[model samples]
Target: MTRPIQINNHPFRFLLYLEWILLAISVITSVLPHPSPRFASRFPELAILNLTIFGLMGLRLPTSNNLVKIIYTACGISLIFITGLFGGRADRLFPFLYIILVIRSCLIFQLPGRLSVTFVSFTLFLTTLLYRIPRYPLPPQAQEKFRFFTLSLALVFGLSLVFVLILMNTVLSERESREKLAIANEKLRQYALRIENQATLEERNRIAREIHDSLGHSLTALNLQLETALKLYQANPDKAQSFLARAKELGSKALQDVRQSVSTMRSNPLQDKSLAQAIDILAEDFQRSNNILLNRQINLEYSLSTEVNTAIYRIIQESLTNISKHARATEVNLEIIINRGSLYITIQDNGRGFDLEQNTTGFGLQSMRDRALSLGGKFTINSAFGCGCQITVDIPLGRLIS
Candidate 1:
C-alpha cells in the first residue's frame, strides 16, 4: 500500500499558525490574574471557547461558498454568546465577537450577504450589552469604568473590520492580475501557431511553382521534340539526331533547375540583410527570371525587426509564386511603403482574376492573411471577375516593425 504524500508546507498554513499564536497571547492576557473574582472564574471557559472557534475557523478557511460559511460563522457566534451568558462577563467576550466579525467579512458574498452578516453581528453586540449591565451587579464607580471599557472595545472592533476589508481587497487585486496574465499568454501562443502554419504553406507554394515552371515546361518541350523526331527519322536522319540531342539537353537543364530551386529555398536571407534589402533582392530575381513585365516600386526606407522581416519576405514570395502560376497576364506590379509607423505592402497583377469568395480554400491567400495577422497586421485582397488581384498588408509598428 502507498502512503499519502505529505506536502503540508504552504503560505496559508503559515498564516494560520501566526493567527493561532496571536490567539494564544490574547487568551493568556485576558485570563492571567484578573482582580475581580467573577471575571477570574470565567477566564478558563472563555479561553477554551476561543480555541474551539479558532480550530473551526482553520477548517473553514479554504471554503468559499456563502451558505456553508454562514453556517460555520453562526455556530461560532452562538458558542461565543453562550460562553458570555454562563460566565456572566459580557465585556470579556468582546474580543471573540470582534474576531468573529472579521472572519464573517472574509466570506465570498454579494452586498446583500455582507449586509446580513453585519446586521447579525451588530445585533449580537447589542444583545450582549443588554444582558450584561442589569444582571451583573456593580457600584456606580464600577459603572463608569464599564462604559469606558465598552467604548474602547467598540473602537477596536471597527479598526479590525477595516483591516479585514483591506486584506480582502489585496487578495482580489492579485487574483485579477493573474487572470489577465494567463489571457495574454494564451493570445501569444495562438499568434505563434498562426505564423508557423503560414510558413509551411509558403514553402508548399514555392515547391509547386518550381514543379510547374521548370519540370512541366521541360517535359512539354521534350514531348514535342520526340514527336518531330519520329516523323523525320528515316527521311532526315541528321535532323532526327539533332532533335533527340536537344531533348536530352532539356532534360539535363530541368534536373539542374530543380537542384538550384531546392538550394535557394533552404537559404535564410533575413540573417544577413534588412527586410527592405531582402524584398528588393526578391523583386530583382523575379524580374530577371520571368518573361512577365515586373514593375517594382518601394516608397519607403524603413527598418524592421528580424522576425517581421522574415514574415514579410515569405508573404511576398508566396504572392509572386501565385502570380506566376495562376495569373496569366503580361504585367505585375509590387509596391512597399511605410505610412504612420506601419509597414504597408501591395502586390498587384494585371492578370485574369478569380473570385475571392469562390476560392476561399486556396491556401495562398489564406496563408498571406495569416502571416499578416500573426504580426498584428491587417490584410485585404480586392479583385473580381476579369479584373486583377491586389493584396494590401499593413503591420503595426509597435507590435512587429519596432
Candidate 2:
C-alpha cells in the first residue's frame, strides 16, 4: 500500500523542511559571483524556473498514478538540464536537485519504481557532464587529469544515488512490517477478549443448569416430603417420622450439590497442588458423591507447567462431573500418562451413552475441548447408544514448557 505525503504532518515535515533548505541553497548560489559573467543574466531566470517546478512537484507528490510520477520526474530532469546548460556554477547544484527528485520519487513509488528513478538520475548526470565537457579545453597533459577527475566524480555521484535509494527502501520496508505486526497483534487481543467473555457466559449457564437440575429437584422433593410428614403427623406417627428422615436426607443432598457448584467456581482449582494430588482429591470427591468405581492409571513422570496442570485438572474434573450427572454407569476408567514427549489423558465410562451426532456440542464437553485447544492440544470424543463414552486429549509437552 502507498502512504500519502502530508507536508504538515510530523512524518513528512522534516522532508519538507529539507527540500526548502536545499532550494534556498541553490537560489543563494545562483545569485553569488562566478568567474563566468556572461552566464550571470541566465542564472536568476533559471533559478526562478527551477524553484517553480520544484514547488509544483511537491504539490502533486501525493498522487499514486504512475503516469503522474513519470511526468513529474520528466519535469525535474528537464529543469536539471536547463540549469546545467545555462546557470552559473550549475555543476554544484545539479547533484542536489537530482537527489531531491529521487527522494520525492520514493514517497510516491514502490521499490521497482524507485530503482528506475535512480537509474535515470544517474544516466542524466552522465549526459549533462558530457555535454559540458567541451566547454573547457585543456592541453594533452591536463586533459588526462580532467578525464580521470570526471570519471571519479561520476562514480561517486552514482554510488551516492544508489546509497540513498537503498536507505529509503530499508526504512520504508521496516515501517511496513511494524505496521502489519501491530495490526495482527490488535486482532489477536480482540479475539482473546471475545473468548474470555464467551467462557464467562458459558460458566454462568453451566452453574445455572446445575442449580436447576440437581439442587432444584432435591429441594422440591424435600418440600413434598416435609408436607407429607405434616399431613401424617396425627394419622400415623411412624410414617411421619420416616418422611421427616427422608426430607432431612434430601436437604443434605441439596446442600452438598450447592457446595460442589461453588467449588467449581473457584478461580484456582489446583490451589498449589500438583496434578496427581489434585486428581486424587477429585477421585475421592467423585467416589463420595456417586457410587461409581473409578479405576485411575496416572503416571505423571514429568513435571508440568501451571497452565497445563490446571487444564488437566479441569478436564478431568469436568469429565467426572458429567459422568455423575448424566452417565448411569457403575465404573469409570481414568488414564493419564506422559508418553513419547506428549501428555496423554483418556477418560472412559461404561455408561449408557447418547447419539454422538445429536449431542456433539454439550456445554461441558465444549468447555473441555476449548481448554485442550488453548494449549495447542487435541480433544476428541467417541460414543454411541448403549456404548460407553470416551474422551481423549493429547498435548505436546514441548509446546507447554515453551
Candidate 3:
C-alpha cells in the first residue's frame, strides 16, 4: 500500500523549520567580511551563492511522488558539488553552505538512502582538500591555514550530516506508525458495522417467523369455522350461532397475538425472564396451538444473556412450528441440561422424517442451525425416512459468561 505523506505532522514541520533556519545562518556567515583574502575577491562568489540560494527557494520541490523526488534529490546532490567547488578558497565563506546542502538531502532521503549521499559528500570533500593542499602554487603559510580550515569543515560537516539523518529517521518512523494505526482503526470500524447488520437481519427474521406462526395458525382456524357456520346456517341456526361465536373469539385472539408478537420484537420481555421461564411460556403455547404432547425438563437456574435466551426461544418455537406443519408427529420430547460448563438441549419427535439428501433445507432446519450457530452453539439433526427427527443444540457456558 502507498503510505501518503502528511507534511502537517509536528515532526515533519520541525524538520522543515530547521532546514530554513540553517539556510539563513549559512547565508549570514557567507556574507560576513573577510579581511585577509580581500572582500573584493570573495564578493563575486558570495553574490553567486546568494543567487543560487534564491533559485533553490523558487524551484518548488514536491513532498510526495517518486519522479519529483528523484529530480529534487539530483538538485541536492548538485548543491553539494557546488558548495565543495566554490568553498575551496581557504578564507572564502561558501563552504559554510555544506550544512544547507546536508539539510536539502535530509528533506528527500530516508534512512540508509542518505548513506549514499554521505559517501558522495565525503568523496567530493576529499577532492576539494587535495586541490587546496600544499602541492599547489599557494604559499606555505596560506596552505597551512587552508588545511586547518578544510579539515575542520569536513569533520564538522560529517557530524552535522549524521545528526540530521538521525532526526529524519525519527520522522519516518512516526509516519509509518500513524499509517498503521489508521489502517487498524478502519478495519475495526468495518467489523463493528458488520456485526450490527447481522443483528438487524436476525431480528427481522425472528419477527417474520413470529407473525407467520401466530397469525397464520389463528387466521386459518378462524376461516374454517366461518365456512362451517355458513353451511350450518340453513340446517341448524343454533349450531351456526355457536360456530360464529368461536370465529369471533379466534379473530380477537389472533389480533392480540399479533400485537404481542410485535411488542416482543420491539424489545425482549425475556430480559426480565430467565431462559427457563421463556421456554416454559413457549411450551405451553406450543401445546395449546398444535394440540401435540410437549414434554419439558428445563432447569436453567442461572440467567443467560437476552440474546441467548431469545435464540433458544426462537429455535424451539420454529422447531415446534415445523413439527406441527410437517412432522405429522403427535408427541415430542423437550429436554434441557447443563453439564461441565455447557448448555445442551434436545428436541426429538416421533414424526415421519424424510431422506436427508432430498429434504436438506426443509422443516426450517437451516434457520434453526443459523440461530444456534449465531449464539456460538452447535446444532445437529438426526433423522431418516419414516424415522423420528431429533435436534440437539450445544453451547459452551464460556460464551454466556461474557
RMSD list, candidates in order = 9.5, 7.5, 6.0
**Candidate 3: deviation at residue 287, Å?**
4.5
* lDDT for each residue of candidate 3 in 1-402, tens digit (9 for 90 to 100): 333333443335554565555555555555555566633234436544653563355234455676776666666556645654554232244344444455455555564546766666666666766664555478878878877888797888677767766766666678779999999999999999999999898778767655655565567667767887899999999988988987897799788887887676543436587777877876775675556899989867566777777777778877777787778888999998888889998999999986777876853677778778887889988889789799999988888653
> Model 2 clash pairs?
none
What are the per-residue Cα lDDT tens digits for candidate 1 across 1-402? Answer: 222111252223544565566556555655566677766645566656665675556544424555666776676667666655554333465555545455445534544555566656666766766666656668989988988887786667656665665675577567658879999999999999999999888778656644554455456556656777898899999988888887787578667667766777433445588776777766665554445787877765555677677678778877887776677767888888878888788999998988987975666666677778889899998887789888899987777645
Tell me the lDDT of candidate 3: 0.68
Whole-model lDDT values for every prediction: 0.66, 0.78, 0.68
Q: What residue runs in model 1 are displaced by over 4 Å at the alpha carbon? A: 1-13, 22-36, 41-50, 60-66, 83-107, 110-112, 134-145, 198-202, 209-216, 219-236, 266-402
Query: 45-130 in candidate 2: lDDT tens per residue?
Result: 77667766775667547656778778877888888767766766644777878888888888778888898889998988898888
Clashing pairs in 1: none
Which ten-residue region of model 2 has the weakest summed lDDT?
A: 1-10
Worst 10-residue stretch by lDDT in candidate 3? Answer: 87-96
Could you say which candidate leads in lDDT? 2
Better of 1 and 3 by lDDT: 3
Which one wins on TM-score?
3
